[model samples]
Target: MVWPPSLRQLEFGDGFTVRIATLKGPPSLQQLWIGHWCDEHIARVGWPMSLQQVFFSGNFDQPIAGVAWPTSLRVLSFGEKFNQPIAEVMWPASLQQLSFGGSFNWPITGVVWPVSLEELSFGDGFNQPIAGVVWPASLRQLSFGNRFNSPIARVMWPVYLQELSFGDAFNQSIAEVVWPASLRQLSLGRWYDQPISGSIFGVVWPASLRQLSFWCRFDQAVAEVVWPASLRHLSFGVCFNQPITTVAWPASLQQLSFGDRFHQPIAE
Candidate 1:
């Protein structure tokens, strides 16, 4: 079916399959969202020149050829079941953000990422170690899902990164890891129930840090940890039972949120 030339966005829900190669439309289209489809179906499609974002929530089990990608695409998100290795796929130079959903277990250590990429995210089942991965220098934000338990301590983080997050299975101590000086926000991995005794204190947090969040299973007392003077926001997860007042609050703190187990009274 021929869509209106003025259409800018197209979205197809589950169980719906549309042959984009057969569809007729103008180059005004910017976003394309589709359900399960094979690489041949995507390769055959004539993508609009103006398309910037492509989101696929289908079963992409086959490898995607470089010709299947649109040069104008800036953001690309794969489905939960897409397990194809992206090493063979030629990422567009314009890409800024890339995400891998569930079931994507390919190792990205040797894969070349687009230099323009600023944000990178991983979903469940991505357990491959990224220690030797050559990360894009332009990266600013990074996140991982529950099953990602890679040892990031050996990875050389981009100096420009501002936000860093980890998955539930990542219980490795980050106290000795050299964090970037540009980091502003940090989110610890969930399911981390270990005591934070003096581990956090051993690391030198960047002065640029503004936000810090604890994982859901963190129930340790952080009173011994020295909070950064540049911190503005702090949050605790569900199982954290430590009293909020026991820790020395930073003078720059403007927002504080505690978990359900914290019943301490605010002295303000």
Candidate 2:
């Protein structure tokens, strides 16, 4: 398919070539989906006519160097062998969702989340550090994997965060995580390391939290399973033989699960 220099919409799949010169005159396109075999070249997407979604997949023979564009992008999803500089990637102010799960790297600088972003998900193989990112104010969900190699310190969660998940290999301390008031579901799973220190759990949790699960090493027993009064689902975990006494469960609890120590089913 021949691409007009001032093209406003372009979608190519298989046996197609997208040369940098194909996109000339700085045409502002609203949608672009490239799933073809193209020559390796760096090109700017120039101005987008309110770009809403973009998808780049499959193996582009040569390293597609410096392919950055889409200043008005709202949703960006990348897949397959994408060895490009992520730092050069720019997101539009109207961006609301971002899902990236491939292999790419750029200089260790920082990421600027869009003002309107609501959801962010990182698939397996992402090892970038989101430590100093200024989170989006309207974000509701942030999901990531253990590939984030840097230690997370302080985070300014959106006042509306409701669901958060960190993959098993993640080793950062949750001591500094300040849950937002609107948070309802929080999960900290499969992490390498024994019993998280008491001081770690000392951080105040969202009073509105309904579901809580700790699947990592709890080398010691928690004297109290402080399940939020609004909590309906609770999961308590202890090391294989770590002893624990009768937990003070909330009457509001509808379902509960305990590990090996409490071999019996949780009472209603």
Per residue, candidate 1 scores C-alpha lDDT tens digits across 1-268 of 6678798998876766555567554689899877775333565677888889988885755566545677889999988778877776788889999998888898788788889999999987888888888888899999988887756657788889999988888777666677888999999888766555584435567788999988688887676777789999999888877655677889999998877777765563
Where does model 1 exceed 4 Å of error? Answer: 1-3, 18-25, 36-41, 194-201, 243-246, 263-268
TM-score, candidate 2, is: 0.72
Clashing pairs in 2: 168-190, 195-219
lDDT against the true structure, per candidate, is 0.80, 0.62
Q: Summarize candidate 2's per-residue lDDT along 12-78 as a digit string, tens digits.
A: 7766665743453324566777664654454544435555676665654333335454556677766
TM-score of each: 0.87, 0.72
| Whole-model alpha-carbon lDDT for candidate 2 | 0.62
Best by TM-score: 1
| TM accuracy, model 1 | 0.87
